[model samples]
Target chain A: MKYIIIASLSSLILQSYLTTILKIDTIFYPLFLIVNLIVLYKYFNKDNLKFIIYALTMGFISETISSNTIFLQPILFLLISFIVIYISNRIEVGNINLFLIVPFIITIYRILSYFILNNIVHISITNQLLYQSIYSSIVINILYAYTLNYIFKFISNKYKFSMYD
Target chain B: MKKIKVNPRYLILSILIIIVVILSFISYAIKSGRQLSPVESLIKDTVLTTQKILMAPVNFVSNSFKEYQEKQDVYKKYKELQKKESLFDLQEAKLKEQQTQIEKLNELLTLEKTLSDYTYQHAQTLNRNLNYWNNEISIDKGTSNGIEVDMAVITNQGLIGKVVSVSTFTSRVRLLTSSDIHNKVSVKIKTDKEDIYGILSSYDKENNVLIIEGISSNKIIEKDSVVVTTGMGSIFPSGVLVGKVESYELDNFGLAYIVKVTPTVDYDDITHVTVLKRLK
Candidate 1:
C-alpha cells in the first residue's frame, strides 16, 4: 500500500515538472514506465492483483493525458511488467543488475513498437532518442527507485501496518 | 483421483494480459477515424479537470517567478516607450489615414479586416505532452465555454496551434510544431511587391524550423518576409501571423521553392492563450 502511494505520487510529480518546469523533451523516454516497472518488481505476488491493476491504471492515465496513443502505453507497460516479474523469478539477480537491465529493455521495446505497431518508417532505431532514453531511465530513475525503496522500507519497518499480508 | 495444482500468480497475470489486449482493441475501435464518442468525452473531461485542479498551485508559483523577472524588463520598456510617445503622436493622424485607405482597399477586395476583429476567449493551458509523432496541449476552455474544433489558438506572440478535440470543460489542441505529415496550413507570404502563396508543411523538429513548400521558383519571395494564414480554409482566419522566412532553396527538380520558417510563438513559454472565434 505504501509503495503504491509513493509510486503514484512520484509519477504525478514527474509528469508535472519534467516537461513544463525542467523543459526536457520526453517524447522518446517516458520516465513513468520505469517507476511502474520498479513497483511491480518490488511487490509482485498472488495476493497483490489489486496493486497490479492500480499501477496499470495509473500508467494508462498518464500516457493518455501526456501522449497521443492512449491504448499503446498501458499495454506495453503490462507486457513489460509481466516479463520483468517472470525474468526475476527465473534468475536470482541483484538489485543493481536489475536496474541496469531495465533501461535497455525499455528502449528496445519502444523501438520495436514504434516500427511494428505504429508503422512509422524512415526513422533510425538507434538514434539520439535511444541514447537519451537510456541515460534518463538509468541515471535518473535508478536514484528515484532507491529513494522510494528506502522510504518504503523504513515505513514498513516502523509502522507495523500489516501491509505485506 | 488427483487434482492439478496451479499458481494463482500465473492465473492473475494471464487475466491481466487478456484485459490489456481487450482494452486496446476497444480503444482502437473508438478512435477509428471518427469523432470521440460521449463516453470518451466524459473520461477525458474528468481527467483534464483533475489535472487542472492539481496544477493550479504549480502554475501559480511558476508564473509568479516569471512575472517577477519580467517586471524589471517591463519597467525599462515603459521608460523607453515614454520617450518615443511624443514623436509617435505626430504620426498617428497620418497612420490613421493610411489605415482607412487600406481598409477601403480590403473591402473592395472582399478580404474584410483579417484576424484583428475575431471574437476570442482566453484560456489557461492545463498541460502539454508529446509522443513519437505529435504534440498535444490541453486548455481549460471547452465546449461549455464556446470553444469548438478547428478554432485558431494564438498567444500574444503569434499562432500557437488549432484545437482538434473539445470536451465540456477542456479542449485538446494540436500544436503547429507537430510533425504529422497531414498537418499542413495554407499560408501567404507578405513580400514588399506582392504576397506569395504556399503550403506550410512538415516541421523539422531538430532544427526547430517549419518547411513551406509548393511555392513556384519564379516568384520573387524575399528572405525575412512574414508568413500568415491565407484563410483559404475556414479553419483559420486570414492574416494571422505564423512566422518569418529564414531561407529558401530550390527543390530537387528545381521546379519549386522550399522555404524554411522560424515560428514566432515560443513553445516553451506557452501558458496563456486565446481561441479565436470568427465573427462570420
Candidate 2:
C-alpha cells in the first residue's frame, strides 16, 4: 500500500517533469492505475473486491486528472476498471499479450467519448490536437507497460505476500 | 463427493465492472448534452500558465542572440560607410539610398500604428520544425501572455505564420512553409500587382527553399519579384512580406506556373516575432 502511494506520487512528479521540463505531452493517469494494480496483484492474493475498488479509484483519478467531465469520470472508471480486473483475473498473469488489453480499452473509450461528446454535447475535437494526443498516449502506454512489468516482478520478489502489501 | 464451486468473487467483480462501464457511457452522454463547465476554463488557464513559465528562459536567450546579430549588422554597415567615404561622390550617393530605405521603414512603422488598434506581443523563436512533415516553431510566449489561436505572427521582415496552438507559457506557430495540404495562402505579385493563390507545395531540402504552386502561367512573373499577403480570406493582414520569387517554370499543364520562393524571414535564424492582437 505504501509502495503504491509512493509510485503514484512518483508518476505525478515524472509526468510534471515530462510536461514542463521536456515539453512532452503524456498521460500519467493510466500509468498510475497500472502501477497500483501491479502492486495489488503481487502483494495481495487477488481479492476481487479490492481490485474493483482500486480500478474504480484509478478510473476516477485518471478521468479527474485528464479533465474529463466530473460526474462521468467516477462512473466510467468504476465500470472500466471492474471489467479490466475481471478479464485480467480470468487470464494468466505471465502472458504479455494481456497488457495490450489496457490500451485497447482506452482507445475504445476515447473513440466512444469523442462521438458522445461531439454528437450529444456538441463539443468538437479539433482534428490536429486529437491526432497528436492519441499518438503521444500510445507511445507513453507502450513504455509504461514495459517498465511496469519489471517493477511488478521486483516488488513481488522483495515483499512478503500479504492481503494488502 | 466434493464438488468444485464457481468463484462468487469473480462473478461479483464482473458484474460491478459491467455496471461501471454502463454508467460511464451514460455520464458521457449526459455531459455531452450540457454546456462546458467553468472547471474546464480554469484548467485551460492553469495549463497556459505552466507553459509560459517554461518558455521564459528560451525566449530571453533567443532575443539576446538576435540583438547581438543586429549589433553585428550595424557594425558591418558602419565599416561599409567608412569605406564609401574614401571613394568618389558616386559611392556617397549609394549610402544616401540606404538612408532613404531606413526612413521609408520608419514611415511604414508609423502607418502600421495608425491602421491597426490591436496590441502586439513580441516573441522570440527558440526552435523551428523544418521537417518535410511539420512546419512549426516554439515561440517564447503562450496563453498566459494573451497569445491565442488564429493570432497573426509576423517578423520585422514579413509575415511568419499564424498561431496554431497555445499552451500556458509556450505556443506553436504554424509556418508558411508547412507541408500540411490544408495550408493555403493568398499571395500577390508585388511587381505585376496580380493575385496568385496556392498551397505550400514543398520545401526544397537541398537549397533550403519553399515552393508555392497553382499560379497562372500567362502572368509575367519573374525571379526576384516580391510576394506579399493579399488579405483575401482575412487570415493575415495585407502587405506582409511572404517571400521573393526564386524560380518560376511552366508545369506539364502549361496553364499554371510552378513558383519557388525564398521566404523573407531567415526561417533558419528566426528569433523574434510580433503576434497581431486583433485578427479579422
Candidate 3:
C-alpha cells in the first residue's frame, strides 16, 4: 500500500512535469517507461499480482490525462510489466546485473509498441522524436536505472525494508 | 448470508478489462459527436481549469522574458524603420488607390454578396498535442464563449485551422498540417492571368509544405503566387490567405498538377488565434 501510494504520486509528478512544464512527452518517453518498470520491479510479488495491476492502472490514469491517445500507454505498460515479471522470475533473486539489460528491453518495447499503435490504430507514429526518444532513453536509462538501484539498495539496507539483503 | 471469496488475479483482470472497454467506448462516442455525460463534463472542466491555473505563472515568466528581449531590440528596429518611413508612405497611398479600384470592380461584379462578414474572437492556446498523428491544440474558449465546431481559426498572418470539438470551457482546433484526408480545404491560387482553384490536400510533413491538388495543367501558375480559401465550402470563409506556392509538378499518376505551398502563418511561433464567426 505504501509503495503504491509513493509510486502513484511519483507518476503524477513525472506526468505533470512532462506535459505542463517541458510540454514535450515523447522526448523523454524512455525515462518514463523505465522508471515505472523499476518501481514495479522493486515491489512486485508473484502471489500478489495486484501490485502489477495497480501500477499499470496508475500509469494508465496518468497517460490518459497527459497524452493525446486514450488506450495506448496503459495497455503497453501492462504488456511490458508481464514481460519483466516473466524474465525476473527466471533470473537469480536480487541480481543487480539484470538492470544492465533494461535499456535494451525498453528499446524493443518502444519499437514494438510504436509498430502496434501505428498498424492497429492507424496513427502516424513516424515523428523523428520517436526515434530520438528510443536512442536517448536507452542511453539515459542505463545511468538512471543504476542510480535508482543504488538508492533503493541503500534505503533497503538501512531500513531493513524487505528480505532481499 | 454466504460469504463470497474472489481470486485477486481474476478480479484485477476483470477490472482492467472493464476500464479499457468503457474508456474506449466513451472516447469513440465523443469522437462521433455525442454530448458529454455530466460526469465527463465535470472531469473535463476541473482538469482544464487546473491546467489553466498551473500554466498562468509559466506563461507570465516566458512573456516577461520575451518582453525584455523585445525592449532591447526596439531601438535598433526603430532606426531601421525610420529610413524606410517615406518609402512606405508612398506605397501605402498607392495601395489605398488600388484598393478603391478593386472595390469598385468588385461592386460591379457583385462579388461582395459572396464574401461573408466575419467577427473575430481571440482565444489563448492552452495546450498542444505532442503526437505526430494528431495536429491539434486546445484553446481557452468554448461554447460558453460562442466558439462552435467547424469555425475557422486564424492568426494575424493567415489561417491556422478550424475547431473540431468544444466543451463548456475549452475547444479543440485541428490544424491544417494534419495529414488526414478529411482536412482538405478548397483554395484559389492568385496569379497574374487569373485565379485558379484547387483543393488543399495533405501537408508534407518532411518538407513543411502544403499540397494543393487537382489543378489543371493548362493554367500557367507562376512561382510564389498566393493561395487563399475559395469559400466554396460553408465551413471556411472565402479570401482567407493560406500560403504561397513553392513549386508545381505533375503527380505520379499525371492526373492533375500538384502545387506545393509554404503557409503564411508560422506554425512554430503561433500562440494565440482568432476564431472567426460569420455574421448571418
User: lDDT (CA) for every model shown?
Assistant: 0.69, 0.59, 0.69
Q: Candidate 3 chain B — worst ten consecutive residues by lDDT sum?
A: B26-35
User: Model 1 clash pairs?
Assistant: none
TM-score of 2: 0.46
Score every model by TM-score: 0.81, 0.46, 0.74
Q: Quick one: best DockQ, which candidate?
A: 1
Q: Which TM-score values does chain B get in all models? A: 0.81, 0.60, 0.82
lDDT string, candidate 1, B53-127, tens digits: 777787789889989999969979999999999899789988999999988989899995565467889998766
- Residue A159, candidate 2: how far off, in angstroms? 6.6
lDDT of 3 by residue, B88-157 (tens): 9899999999989988998999875555568899988765543333367767798899989889999989
Off by over 4 Å in 2: A1-89, A92-95, A98-141, A152-165, B1-38, B47-144, B154-161, B164-184, B189-214, B220-280
RMSD of each: 5.0, 10.4, 5.8
Q: Scored by Cα lDDT, where does model 1 land? A: 0.69
Q: What is the C-alpha lDDT profile of model 1 across A19-51, one tens digit per residue?
A: 444444543234654455654455545343664
Q: For candidate 3 chain A, which ten residues in a row score worst on lDDT?
A: A21-30
Pairs with backbone N, CA or C atoms under 3 Å apart (clashes), candidate 2: A1-A165, A79-B20, A79-B21, A121-B32, B48-B168, B49-B168, B51-B169, B52-B168, B52-B169, B125-B271
Q: Report the lDDT tens digits of candidate 2 across residue range B1-280.
A: 9998879999899988975776566556333422224554354345334444665676579669989989879978998888877775886789999978866986978654422335689986544331111246656687779988777899899877887666665666777665444456777766756555664556564455677777777778867988877665556666678788898888898898888888887654456689987633
Q: Which stretches of candidate 1 lie over 4 Å from their true place?
A: A2-6, A13-17, A26-30, A46-52, A67-70, A90-102, A116-140, A162-165, B1-34, B102-117, B130-134
DockQ of each: 0.28, 0.08, 0.15
